[model samples]
Target chain A: MIPGYITTNAPALLIAVPLLGAFLSPLIGKISRDARALWVLAVMTLTALIGYFVAFLVYTEGTLLYVFGATNATLAVPPDSGGIPIRIIFTLDAMSALMVTIAVTVGFAVILYSLTSDARRSGLEAYYTIFLLMIGAILGMVSTGDLFNFFVFLEISSLASAGLVAYKVEKGRAVEAGLKYLLVSTIGGIFFLFAIGILYGQYNALNMAMLADMIQWTPLDKLALVLVVAALAAKCGAVPMHFWTPDAYSMAPSAVTAMLVVASQASLYGLFRICFTLYGITLNYVTIGWVIIILGILSMIIGVTMAIPQKDIKRLMAYHAVSQTGYMLLGVGVGLAVLGDQALLNSYGMTAMEGGIFHIFNHAMYKGLLFLTAGAIIYQVGTSDLNRMGGLGHRMKWTMIFFIIGALAIAGIPPFNGFASKFLIYESVFAFSPLLSIIAMVVSILTLASFVKVFHSVFMGPPLPGNEQVREAPRTMLIGMTILAAIVIISGIFPEFFVQNLITPAAHALTDQAGYISAVLGGA
Target chain B: MRMSKIVRFGADVLFGAIVIFGLYVIMHGHLTPGGGFQGGAVVATGAALVIVAYSYEEVIGMIKKTILMAQESAGLVMFAGVALIAIGLGTTFFFNFLANSGSLFGMTVPFGPNPGELNTGGVLPLMNIAVGIEVWGGLAIVILYMLSGIGKTKEA
Candidate 1:
């Protein structure tokens, strides 16, 4: 039997361990750099273990609720509180579990990659601290069932990521990009807070489940929804508000850019949680659904078209990040559009949602791998410009292989994870609307074309002057890329297994509003 | 870049008083309106006054950046450590284990309004102190670094 403490406290431990380790990083750095690196690794490993353990428990037992500051961890509503859950609660269902798994997995790989890749950098203590804090913030944002708590975590992530983005201060452009990111995110955060305030003023509750239980779809609530959707859409780099994304992603350290993909997905998760759980079918589902779908289409079309002409390789990948986010939005948006109709929801809406949720996982893995490969190229070749790179396939064989895997997976080729999710999306979404599906297919083609150009320019030609002596990426960086590469390949080949086991459950958790509400407020 | 001697003397005189008041606010955070963040900012304001009054060279001599960074880290570790201790006691994280247990900061009071007691909040006061220290260190270091950067720009 699992120890009772471990089983009961895994949710808290998952976030707290990284937070503690983050602060302790600088102190440990004082002792020795190697010691600090090992400490960070140990902390991330423990966090990942606890995260997977929690996911396992959530899958087997259904939604798990842990009430902070309570005598019993699972006691969400104390007898004295008169049927109200007053304490901050963590409500982990399959969806949250999935997001947590993605975060910890990517976080662990990024830190491992950074260990050797950034060994020579100065002020590494601060770098590792902010990275751990970002991980902890993402974990907290996904798991918490409190709106206020979610806001707190969102701000923490925004600030920590901004610091990471600005870490390369010697590069004036990096500082400028970080500033833009900071300004945009701060505005988004403030809008989110305003929405939270509106909801609190109406319902007098900060807990997500409680607010959902009491939500009345009043004008104030509608306003709150608008504010929330806009803020989170911006935060997640959807369409018109995606100006800061390319700059930030291109300028940040490669490992951070990879983790930033997961960070933005956390915001996307919050957007879904608010719409599905907070509003449910009470509000106007069709309109909101179409809004997200339109955003997705715009992102897909514009993000790729813009990416095709970029000379900087990382900037091009950053645009792809925006493009991939569109696929997820489209998938879930279709599900939302059909939320009110039971017949339609059961027939294709569920599949669309699964496709979208599965895409979140696949996109994180492949895109993370792609960014790390780009980082590897930069590490060996000393530049991110495609024009300045060539024939790296000879010297950097492992990196070339990793980059090819990422490129193939991202282009939706068969026997890769991206195709499986996109296939689900296309089949289901075509049943919903063929035009949207066609747009999506065209976007995929553009994506493939862009990556093909990038691959040829960066690796296929004769070695350019000053690039002939390029070498393979460091062992740890390759190890990091390999972890994600392995996942992309394995999940691609076994898509059905992951879809049936993890994605289906997570999709159900997203749409099953009554089950989510009852888990926290109705049950013990 | 030094201020007038009179201004420096006044800054020194007010620093201790400001810190003491800030500590008072942090200690009584659970019962009063002020809390760790506010109190810490107040203390940092005092540090900023001192930083402004002295030259960067003299300021570096008086207050080291490494020590401030350590202080900030220690404060956060302590805060997280206190929360984690609850897990060791076989309860969930952030559990108010000491509340009414007659341990450190463990005093129970009757509900519905009475004269406030500083010792009744269980771990909140300790959390307040931890945050106060952290904010004090964090805000002060930011000011110090900014000033140092300004100094470098001037020299260049």
Candidate 2:
């Protein structure tokens, strides 16, 4: 049974609030622009509060399973159906709860940033509507217990985010890039649905727990697995499949680009969920793990090298986002590779998983901050091209500081959040293969090199002749960046605590498949 | 892009008939194959017929953007609000509190197929109507926005 508090339905309310907000946004916009903005902020903040409350409950009370449309609300298990849950259920485990926290935080910050940025122009109604819908879709994608439900949410998010990416219609290229993003994401969504259909056809179950129990790991199952991995990999921008990342990220408004990073993370989270939980020990772990690792290395090397030559600031960050996603894949890939040995899994593999999971939160913060700062520059200078940027350190001191923190944090420098997670990854991965650790280190140095170039090119030069009137970004944008920058700083200072409190529980939730299965089935 | 007067007159008659049929499909969804989405598509078809019969300028004059948006939003709010009512009733979200409760949309049915009561399926009918309105307004809005886009391109 759920807890006896208002927080009992927080998980459902978390999704409901944003969804209702999205529908109401245009209506409220008709009343007054300021009312519409306040309404959006209020809705987002409410969702965030509910998100944190549910996450805290999950942390303290173990996993929570919520079944929709049940005759008996507390009963997830139907009596006569032999321990099968019939209706739609939302499972709030530690892993999903953590992701929910990241999504809500980033979304709220982005909305705040958008209030004062270039996104505040006309058409604010459609902008906020799609914006909230995109956030709700991400929440749905990360939190749903049904596989088909995840696919549905994934499609919604991809479409909504693509629409948001094209919000800047004044720029012809934004529309073009949005079409490409939409094309690739739609194709990936189709393949993902096909994979879900295969699994459903075989097992006759849409619920993840029931499917996990019924799966036979047959050839068809392996085909389904490959399709899932490929689809999610493409959506999340993994190496060979990552061509759309730069185009979409660079073309979208900066606030939108920040949220897009989190959207891609939701896809990566789906990939991990499918690999570790759905298919778990049923398939060949070694080969699949190698597939992820090779992709990680390629993303790391290719992404960083590609970023170094970029003239556009947002495009550079987009490539680096791909590179940073590599760290997560490599860290978790090492965990997957060593899952065959139980003793190895308990010791090194679990640590590797924690490192990867830790990086998920850290990257969302610093990378989001980086994108927001890029947006701030664009807001001030009317461009994101690095060649045309200079001397913002004088007028926009706060933005400069924030950008430096973001750059330093992402480059894995000491006493930053990136260094802490990358440290865990390097230390744990070395035992699996020293060469992997070495490659990760080289990627880190290259990351530093690229960011230093950005710092010099964007903020360290003399003010250009045409840019004398450039001012600091609006107070709201600075406030938005400050949220992420503060998170990056605090998490960096207390990595051990965050790891113990947040990352460990999430890692346990992922590796503990039997816990998930039993939690649902045992409820009967 | 207007059609001839006879074609426009025929479309005007067809629109009313199609909307009635769509509402029939939506209302009878509890006992039939076609449901809210299908019914909504039917209604949208009616809207498309209207748009096709008139010039883009004439169509813009006839269609109110705010009204369609309100319809869509109101439908969504009704849908979510129905689900939220369960939470207010100390049950789970979308628990169908009206089911077997003898309230609106509440009347228990016997097992197996029989002559269905209009109120037998509980919140399902409500959900169907809500989703039908949402889809109807959503599809119509998409067409209007697209036609407007075309108008802009033609001017440019």
Candidate 3:
């Protein structure tokens, strides 16, 4: 049996260890670079372990509620407090556990890749420090059961990631990209705060569970809901609010770009959590669901079409990130559309949600792998422009292989994780509306076309001038890519296994609003 | 460019006073309105005054960037460490294990209104101090770095 202390405190430890490690990284760097690298590795490894352990416990035992600063970890509401949980609580249901798992896994891989890829860069200590802090913030954002706490983590992550985006200050335009990201994020954050104030004025509660129990879909609630959905959609790079996605993703160091994908997904998680759990069936589900679906369609069409004409390799991939986010929104939005109808929901809505959530994992792994490969190319070629690159397939064998795997997975080719999720989404969404499925398929085809162009441009022809001597990526970078590659293949081949274990539980946890409320408030 | 002698003298005189006031705010945070962030910003404003009074080279000598960076990191470490100590003591993370324990900063206050006690509020005071030190260092270093960047721009 797991130690009681560990099982009890795993949620807090999952966030705290990385936060402590971030502050301690700079100090250790004062000792030696190698020491600092090893320190970061140990911290990330421990965080990943705790993350997976909490996920395991949540999957097996059920939703876990950890109340901070309480007499006991499980004491969400004091006996005399009249059913109100005043303290900050972490609600680690299967949905939160899945998000945590993705953040830590990508975090570990990114840090490992950065160890060798960024060894020669200046300001190594600060880079790793901000990296760890971002990881902790993402974990905190997904797990916290308090709206105010979620905002706090959101701001922390925004600041940390903005700093990392500008880490390559000498690289012209990076600082510009970082500034744009910060400005956009700050605006979104203000909107979120405004909505929180509106909700607090109405409900006088910050705990999500309490607020959900009390929400009555008043005018103020409707106003708050609009503000929240807009803010979260902007944060997650949805259409018309995704202006910063290409700039930020293209300019940040590759490892940071990879983790940014997960960061945005955390915002997506917030959007879903609010819609499904906090509001649930109290509001107009069909209207809100249709709104999300329209956003998804816009993102898919615009993201892929824009991606086709991009000359910069990373920028191309970044647009694809926007496109892939649509698939997830499409899948889950379909689920939300039918949420009020139990019979329809039982037939296809759950499958759509499972597909959406599963796609989050698949997208993180494959997209992360793709970004790492692009970084490797930039490392050797010193440019991310497709027009200036060619014929690296012979020299960088492993990077080429990883790129192909990521490319195929993202394009939804069979036997890849992306295909499994997309297939589920297609079949389920088609049942909802045949037109939506067709739009989604067209987007996937465009995604494939763009990647094919990238593959041909970067690795197909004879070696371009001054690139003949380019060698394979370093051992650590290759190993990092290898880890994600292996996951993509395994999950693709065994989609049923992962969907049954991870995605279905997450879908249930998200849909079961009463269960979530009762878990924290103590009774039905 | 350096400021006038009168401005420099005024800054020098007010620096110590500003820092002490900030410390007072930080120390009495649990009982008062101002806490670590506010107090630390107050202290940092004093440092900014010093920076404005002198030139970049002179300010660099007065406040070393490395030391300030270390100070910021140390403060955050301490804050997290104090919270983690609760878990070590068999309570949840951030639990006020010292409150009402009759130890340091552990005196129990009466329920009704009375004169506020300095030796109460358990770990809050400690956290305030930690955050105070951090904000002081963090804000000061940001100003220092900005100045350094300006110096570089001028050279170029």
Leading candidate by lDDT:
3
Candidate 3 iRMSD, 1 decimal: 0.5
TM-score of each: 0.98, 0.97, 0.99
lDDT of 3 by residue, A284-342 (tens): 99999999999989999999999999999999999999999999999999999999999
Between the candidate structures 1 and 2, which one is better when assessed by DockQ? 1
Categorize the docking of model 3. high
Task: Evaluate model 1: give its TM-score.
Answer: 0.98
Task: Judging by DockQ against the true structure, name the best candidate.
Answer: 1
The RMSD of every model to the true structure, in order and in angstroms, is 1.4, 2.0, 1.3
User: Where in model 3 is the C-alpha error above 4 Å?
Assistant: B111-115, B149-156
Residues A179-291 of candidate 2 have per-residue lDDT tens digits of 98999899899999999989988888888888877788999999999899999999999999999999999999899999999999999999988888888888788899889
How far in Å is the alpha carbon of B51 misplaced in model 1?
1.8
- By summed lDDT, which 10 consecutive residues of candidate 1 chain A come out lowest? A165-174
Better of 2 and 3 by lDDT: 3
What does candidate 1's lDDT look like per residue over A378-436, in tens digits?
A: 98888999999998888899988988889888889989999999999999999999999
TM-score of chain A for the candidates in order shown: 0.99, 0.98, 0.99
TM-score of chain B of 3: 0.92
Candidate 1 chain B, run of 10 with poorest lDDT: B147-156
